[model samples]
Structures are given as structure tokens and as C-alpha cells.
Target: MLFVPLPFVNALLLALVFVFLKKSNGATATRAFLMLIALCCLQSIVLGLRWGYNVDALRFVQPLLAALLPPLAYESFRGLVDQAAPGRFRLAAAPLAALVILGLMLAAPILLDSALVLLFLAYAVALARIAWRGPDGLGLARLDEAAAAHRALWLAAFCLCLSALFDLVILFDFERSGGSHAAILVSNANIVSLLLIGLAARTAGHAQTETNTEPEPAPQTATSEDAEIVARVDALMTAQHLHRDDTLNLSRLARRAGLPARQLSQAINRVCDMNVSRYVNDFRIKDVCTLLRQDGITVTEAMYRAGFSTKSNFNREFLRVTGMTPDQWRKAESRDLEQKDRMAR
Candidate 1:
């Protein structure tokens, strides 16, 4: 009888997710997420080898992989909202820093663990700050999938923070028990953390497909700048039906409106009193309502016609905008029309 380790099972799960994402999106997904998932799978395999098979060589490799995860998580999400990434030197710095810490592990092992805890916590806080801005913060994410991306941002932050906590627990376990509990603690905690981080990164990558492009300058106006921006965006939305593009995002919408993404988001927030996702959904829901009112149009057809890609989002936005389900709205409309017709007769 062969025994398979849980970490190998976990690695298999992440591999499946990676394959699915690759097949679904091809090269469109941010490479950072793909790297993150690949690293996760590698880390899982390393863990399995070290703990399950007691591969002594992997004892040194584990911390290096641990150091890479947080930075990848940060880069994956940073790419979603921020069009400008750090310079090449800055990009090289993270790996260099990780290597420095790995070197320190040879002389002072505790320092490596402490640095990992701090690194994870720092990235967690950074992710949390971005997520605090709501879905609009994900300017590159599609309007329809922004909510999922926002949730994923929060989840990624929590996962990083949770990884920090588990490291602390492992440190205490090592101090109190000569690292007897380290295997079980790391196995269970890291498996959960890695899976969650993979899921979050995947969700974010799905919503983030836009390449960096220079945005057109917003019109310079003496007054009512927000209103002017909104008016221009509205005209674009109405004339081109930009809202009907299922892949539409704040960056794309801003580009079409000839406004910077941040400026466009802020203008919509002030003028419409809603985030970009909600404002875009407002247009989609309104279009869906019109479609629903027409004869021979099914609810699903209405949803798709109105640029809603998911039934849940379509239903949610429909209820939010119309205060009723599509069928209920249709029935109410029918009843009202019948009453009006009888009164006319």
C-alpha cells in the first residue's frame, strides 16, 4: 500500500487550478499570478518531500520559497490596479532581499523566520490598503468582475496575514518544544494559506486582462470638472453603448472618455455618488430592464443582451435597480397594462 502525503494532494489541487487558468485565459492572465501559482505548487511539493519523505536537502530550500510567496502575491495584485510597476531595479530588489535573508539563515536562523513574518505582514497591509478603496481601486478589473476581484484582494491580504500568524505560532512551537510540532503546524497552516492565496491571485488575474496604455488627458475646464467628466463618460456610454461591453473596465472606460483612470473614478464617485462598478452596473441594469419589458425576451437573454456575464450579478443588479425580480416586474407591468386597457374601454 502506498501512502500519499496531504501536501502532495494540496500541490495537485493547485496544479489543476493552474492548468485550468492557463487553458481558460491563455496568455492574457498576468504572469505574476501564474508564477505565484507555480511557486505555490513547488512549495507544496518541497514541503511534501521535506516532511513526508524527510528529504534533508529541502530543509534549506523551504525558507527561500517562503520568502518568494509574499512578493509574488503583492506583485500579482499591484498589477491589477496600478498601471505603472516599479522600475526593473526595484523589481530585482525583492529577490535580492530574499537571497540576503536566506544567507542570514545560515548564521542566524531566527532572523529568516522573523523577516518572513514581517514581509508577509507588510504585503498584507499593502493589499489591505488597496482593498480599502473598494472595487473602484481595481481600475484594470472588468466592471462585472470587480466585486470578485475586490473580495479576492481582501482574501489575499487575510491569507498573507494568516501566514504571518502561523509563522509566529511555529516560532513559539519551536521555542517551547524543540520544533517537534513544526511539521504538523507548517503542513496544515501553509496548505490552507497557499490554497487561499492561489485562489485569490487567480480571481484577481481573471478580472485583470488589460495591458498598460497611456490614457488620454481629461478636458481642462475652469469649473464643474467632475460634472464635465461625467458628462463625457455618459455621452460615450450612451453613444457607443460602452456599458454593453462585458469586458469593460474603469481603465477602458476612462480611455474611451479621454480621462485618466483615477480622475475618471473620482469624478464618477463624486458626480454619481457610486463606485465605477455600480455606476456601470446601473447602465447594464437599465438596459436589462428595457429588454425585460419587451415581449419574447427571456430573463437570461435580457441579462446577456445587457452585458451581464453572470446570472447572479445580473439578478442582483436587476433587483438593486428595479426593486423587483424580472418576472415580478413583468407581471406587475402586465397587470398595470390590463387595468389601463379596461379603464379605457
Candidate 2:
């Protein structure tokens, strides 16, 4: 039967994930993903034994595991991308565990089927929205080191979507025909989902385990250490005139100051009271101010020389820093000079 190969494939993937969990460093995200893989493997084993071998003992728990798939998949996605993701639903399992015992006792297959359909539909939509936003939407590290890891998150989103579709197929098939063919179909689908989810989990595990991205060097809180970091960044910016580069960004300043990009961003936000980009623009605006006071220098030239690439951004930053438009500031300075010359006459 087509169902014969399901258990073996699931078992193999289960063993790989078990090894992954045992050998690799224990990160929360990696652990959650491993749990997802383990759940998939168990789902495969249960579905295969129930339909393939006509075993009744594991049949009752199959739908319960089905109910778990959506939330578990979403949780795994959250773990792979963000370590701070909530596992509050894991607590819901205790009550669900009690219900699982009741389902086994009563053999209420309808309840399990209904739960699986609703849960998968809701969380599948949630995962799809996350995918729509891309890797940056997942809150991954904003560094080049995480480039390879972005693909993994994309794969994770794709796998979650496919898993949702697979659940719907299984649900529809089970409702229309509770025959041997349906069992074969369901068993085969579970096996396929297991393999796909295993790939996703493995990719996610690799991203989390690998130290490719810059680790967060400091906390978000305002600490006494921020003053020291801010001072160092200020010295570097002023000494090297780094604000003259139109392409300047947080990472470059962080590198120049010998601090982590996250720490540098946080220090600027805390000590200088603005984000890294705004703080840099403030410096650029100051340069623009100096150049504006001189004769024969147009506002456009002043803005370009101050490292601004676009007129709109230069105007925005100029207004934000000085509370006046570039032209307004220039005309005001000219008026002051005229008044001084008139007094001298």
C-alpha cells in the first residue's frame, strides 16, 4: 500500500531532529522547532499505525495531535525568527491534555476534527501575513551576517502555508469518505507534511544555531554604560566627519565606534535622545547651517555638500533640526547681515 512507507519516513525525520536537539546548543527557538518536528513525527506514526496497520489504540489521539499542528507550527515560526515569542499556548495544552484523555475515553472524533479545522485556519492566516511582510518583518537581525538566515525564514513561512492546505485536504477527505482510500490518503498526506516540516525545522535550527549575525551587545534599557558608548560615538563622528557620507548608516557608525549596531542604536536613542539616523541627520543639518551663512553658496549646494542625496530628505532634516525651512534660515541670516551693515553705515 502507499501507506506502508509513511512510518519509516517519519521515523527517519524524527531521529534526525532528535539528534539535532541533542547535539546542538540549546536555544529556545531551536528547541521549539525541534518540538515541532517531534510532533510531526508523532503525527505520522499515529496516522500510519491507525490506518496502515488497523491499530485502534493510537486512533483516538490522532485528531488531538491534528489540533496541535497549527499552533505548534506558528510557534515554531515565531521561535525561529524571534526568541521573545510567546509560548502561552503551551500552557493551554495541560487542559487540552485532560481533554485528550476524555476524547480517548469517549472516542468523540467530531470534536477533534472541528478543533483541527478551526485552529489551522486561524493560525495559517496569521503565518501568511507574517510571510507577506518578508524576512525584515520577522524581526531578524539587521546585519549582512543574517542574509542566509532570511531564506530559511522564508522557507519556514512557505512550509507553514502548505501545512495548512494539507490539513484542509485531510479534513475534507475524512468527512466525505471514511474508507480505506481515505485512510491511505490521510496517512500519505501526513507523511508529506512531516518531511516538509522537518526541512523547515532543520533550516530554522541552522539559522538559530549559527552565529552569523551580530549578537545583541547591550540591553534596551538606559544604563550608565550608554553614556560612555554615546561619548565614543560622538568622538568618532566629529573626529572623522563620518556624517559627510550620504550612505552612512547605523552599522557603519557602530563599526567606527567599536560597538555593536544594536548597542550603538540604543545608545544614540538613549543619550542623544534620537534614533541613529536622526542623530546623523542632525549633524548633517549643522554642516548645512555653516555652509548656508556663506555668500555664493545656494541651498541645493549646501544640502549636497552636507551629504544629503535628496532635496526632500535634506529639507525634512533641516526643518526637524532647526524648526525652519532651509530657505527661511538662509533668508533670515541674510536679513541679519543686512541689518548689521545698515547699523555700520
Candidate 3:
């Protein structure tokens, strides 16, 4: 029997995501994200056909999807967060190359499952690393929104790991004529993962709207010149205390620093090893710490003064940067000061 509602709904939801994403504000990376989601949804259908319906003719779809997943995942991630992307056709060729690799898989069917599992685990680790660092690099966002975006990625990586587990289970089920539970679990997991991936694309994917107002500068090359750019940006940040603006964003910072957006982004990435959004938030975080050390200033007031829009945002960024909650950090500082006073006495 065909798995009608669930698999069909999964594909339909993925299609809707594709439609929305194509129209959404983003670049090559966004498109790659769409492709990644599409592949996942399609896998649900392919799996349904091969396993649920026992359609042996559609068996080829699995190897094709398997081959395309790893590169597409890595490329989508790079595009999502990087200042530059590979040439259009070059990026487009990844799946085609995967299709070409299918010949080797066909030649050695026994190695196919092992190789695919290894590739999935490798990309999952890479994705998790990028997520932990932050999603500020992926697109324009406020500090709070950037944290949410990165969390979306963390979830995506978790889902990918889950997908790999489901794959293994389905393989085992295929080997033993047993319960259909594994197939059901695999499809449902794909549905859940697709939903989260779509959320991440929405949360983090953005095209530069404000860039149209300014003359776009030529793309900066990777070179030592980035050092000077970073120094100048740092000076501007410190002198102006630009992070204190609650409305601060990459485009606005670029304007105030009198630098092209791309160059400024590159400088921040080079020197701070972070996206401009996170770099700015780091300043805000420091300011908050200083405020928290002072008496009579409430945490909410300090967070607001530091330019955070909400306490949740402040707490999330605080934990990520400081490894403690705002209240916990404040309490520790208070204890240290009390101990210092006793020593002075």
C-alpha cells in the first residue's frame, strides 16, 4: 500500500518551501538550501516507493540522492555564510558530479552504504561546528535573531544525524523481513527535519536590501590588505561605540565605517573571526558585563543600554559568549566583590 498522506504531505510541504525560498531574499547559498530541502523531501518519496510499495524499478533513486546529499549540504552551508560563492555553473555541477559518481557506486554496490554513511557523518560534524560558532555570518540579523538562526542550524545537524540513524535502521529492516516501523520512522523523521531546515532558511537567509542604495564595490580578494581594513573598522567601532545602536546591522555599520559591505564583512571575519552581527554583539555583551558589575542597574536596564531588544536575546547571547546566564554571571561577580572587600579590610 502507498504511504499516502504523510509522504505526500512531506513532498508538498517541501515544494512550498522551495517556492517561498526562491522568492525570498538570498543568494546562491539560499538556492543550495532549497536544493538540500528538495533532496530530503524527495528521499521520502523515493523511500516510500521502494520500500512501502515494493517498487523495485525506483531503486536507482536512492543512490542518486545519497550521492548528491554531502556536497550539496557543504555547498549550501558555505553559500549561506560566506562572503563569496563559487561561480554559478560550477556550483550547479555538484549534483551532476554526484550523478557521475553513481557509476562507481553501481560498479561496487557493497561499498555504497558505507561510503554514504561516512559522508553524512562528516558533513554533520562540519554543520554542527558552523552552527556552534553562530549564524551571524549567514545573513543580516539582529543579535537575538542571529542566535535563533544558529539554533536552527544546530537542530538541522541533529536531524541529519537522526536521518543517518534512520537510514541504518531501514537497511537493517530490508535485510530482515520484519515490522514496517523503521520505514514509518524514517519518513516521519524526514518530515520533521524538512520542517526545521525550512525554518533555518527563513530565519537566516537574506539578500542585502540596503545594498541597492549604495554603489556596490568590487569584491575584495583574500589578502593581507584585510588587516588594514580590520584595524580601521575596529577604530570606528571603538570611537563611535556603534554597537550601542539598537538598530545596528551590517549595512548600517558599513555605512558608518565608510567601507563597502563586502570589505567590512571580510574585515570582521578576518580579524574577529566572526560575522559583523556577532562582532557587534560581542561589544554589547562586554558593555552588559560592565553594567552588571555596577550596583542599582537592573539586568533589563543594562541589557537595553547595551542595545539588546529583549532579555531573552541578552540571556541567549550571554550564555553563548560567557558560558553562564545573566543572573548567574551577576551573582558570581557579586560574590567576588564581597570577597575582595573582606581582603581589603
Candidate 4:
């Protein structure tokens, strides 16, 4: 009555969801997605054997499977977030093959428990590395709404890793105390972790499809009207310093430029090669640099005068464009100014 069939039911559900996602969207065709589903299925099968068939031997399989799943899931989600082509066998095949070999070694029931624990620890370390690197090695700013969705997926993967770590701890406790409580605890933990992983898979699949299918906005063809529009917006920005307004939205900016909102959006996207927020931030960041360098304004005051609502958003956009923080920009400017001062002296 340990609800033995539950794991298989979960596995089948995961498999069905994955297949549907894969068929519906090419973007979801990622190794991470496939591997995660496979991991769930394997875990379910092993758990069913342990429960229904009284195959105590299947217990050794859990740690190895758990060890590999999180990092692979993290890596897959990372690739999806970045919109980069995922690596082939290099990413998942090597570790998966190793896990299979290790599982075979454990088949004899003579495997050293310490070795298996170490393997699990090593997998955890690898997962920690993936979490640290984040999406695309570009850090958080590069993550758009789609990338953020994938980041949330990675967070779920982290939780699964934590659950596995907890299982290892319980196993250690059982080893010392000669109790069967760890087995029950691990079974319950698996059920919970499997549910979490299923949710992550669904999210990742949705994110992939959503990101890939989103149509790119049409570019504005250069025309006399386009030039006039740019000139008008540029004049307004120069005159009113609208660039400094952090709350500057599309409608307001469109009104200032004397163009309709949709046309204004099209013009900026076509001409400037960025969205309205990014377009505004580009000028704001430039003004911030100028104020910091020429006027010796503090970053906070510069940010406010440039129209940014918050320092955090300012820093994020600044880094997105310049590939450095405002503080970094200030320091670099200071160094250059110091050099100029020395020459003057």
C-alpha cells in the first residue's frame, strides 16, 4: 500500500507531455528535454521494481540516476534560454553512458557505498557549476522574459538536486542507525521530486515553443518619412532631455515625436535595431556616462536625471548595452580622467 503504481503513472504522464511538446514545437527538440523525460521514466521503472517486485537491488540505482538528471536538465534549460543550438552527444551522452556502466557495476551488490556517494557528490558539483554560469555565460541581464522562464526551470532543477542530496543524507543516517526509515523517506522524496521535475519539463517545453515561435517585428525601411520621424524624436530628446525620464513609455515618446505609437515603435525597431525600452535606455546610459565623466555627477543623480526609475534597472540595461556596470564605467572614466589630469599638470 505504498502507492507503488504512482511512479509509473507519473512516468507515463511525463512521456506523453514530452512527446506532445516535441511534436508541436521544433524548439522543444532538445537533449535536456529528452534526457529529463528518460530520467523520469527510468526512476519510475526502478521504483516500481523496488515496490512491487520486492527487488531491493533497484535501490542502488536511484543515486546514480538522481545524480545525472539535475545537471543535464539545467544544461538543457540553459541552452533553450540562450536560444543557442544545443550540443549533441557531448552534452548528455557521456555522463549517461557512465551512469549506465556504474549501474551495471552496482548490479553485483558488491559496489562500495562510498564510491556511489562520491559520484553523486561529483554530479552535484557539476550542477552547481551550471547554476553559477547561468544562461549563456552572459549573466542575468541577458536573460529576457523567455530566458527568465528558462531560469525558473533551472531553479526547479536545483530543487531536485537538493532533494537528492537530502536522500543521500538520510541514507547515511540509516547506515549508522541500522533503520529502514531512510528507505521510506527516500521513496516519499522521489515522489515529490518527480512531481517537481514534471512541472519543470512542462515549463521548459512551453518556453521553447513560445520563444521560437515569437515573430520578429518587421524592420522600418529607410524613407523620407523615417528620417523625419527620427529627426523629430531626436529633437524632442535633445530639447526636453526626455532620455532622462525613466518612466518614458511608448505613447509618451510617440507623442513627443509627433508620431502614432505603432509607427514610432516600428521606426525605432527598424532604424535603431532595438525595442523602445532599449532605445530609450541607450540614450539614458550615454547621458549617464557623459554626466559621470564630464560633469562629475554621482551615479544615483545621473541615473535619476537620465530618467531611470531604479538603480537596479539602470545597472541592468547599462550592462546589457555596454557590457559593464555603471560603477565599472565610472571607474574606467576616472582612470581616463586621471590620465588627462596628469598630462595637464
Leading candidate by TM-score:
1
TM-score of 3: 0.59
Order the numbered candidates by lDDT, best leading. Answer: 1, 3, 2, 4
Assess the local accuracy of residue 122 in candidate 2 as a C-alpha lDDT between 0 and 100. Answer: 68
- What Cα-based lDDT does every candidate model obtain? 0.83, 0.64, 0.67, 0.60
The worst-scoring run of ten residues by lDDT in candidate 2 lies at: 209-218
RMSD of each candidate relative to the true structure: 3.2, 13.5, 8.1, 14.4
Question: Which sections of candidate 2 miss by over 4 Å?
Answer: 1-4, 21-29, 85-108, 139-161, 174-177, 209-345
Question: Between which residue pairs do clashes occur in model 4?
Answer: 244-306, 244-307, 245-307, 246-307
Please count the clashing residue pairs in each candidate, in the order shown. Answer: 0, 0, 1, 4
**Candidate 4's C-alpha lDDT?**
0.60
Q: Which tens-of-lDDT digit does each residue in 61-82 have in candidate 2? A: 7766766766676666654344
Q: What is the TM-score of each candidate against the true structure?
A: 0.91, 0.53, 0.59, 0.48
Model 3 segments more than 4 A misplaced:
1-3, 23-29, 87-93, 135-144, 176-182, 206-255, 258-345
Predicted candidate 4 versus true structure: per-residue lDDT over 163-239, tens digit per residue: 65765677677678874665565555666677666666655554342121112244557667766777788778878
Per-residue lDDT tens digits of candidate 1, residues 304-344?
A: 87888888888788898889998898899889989999999
TM-score between candidate 2 and the true structure: 0.53
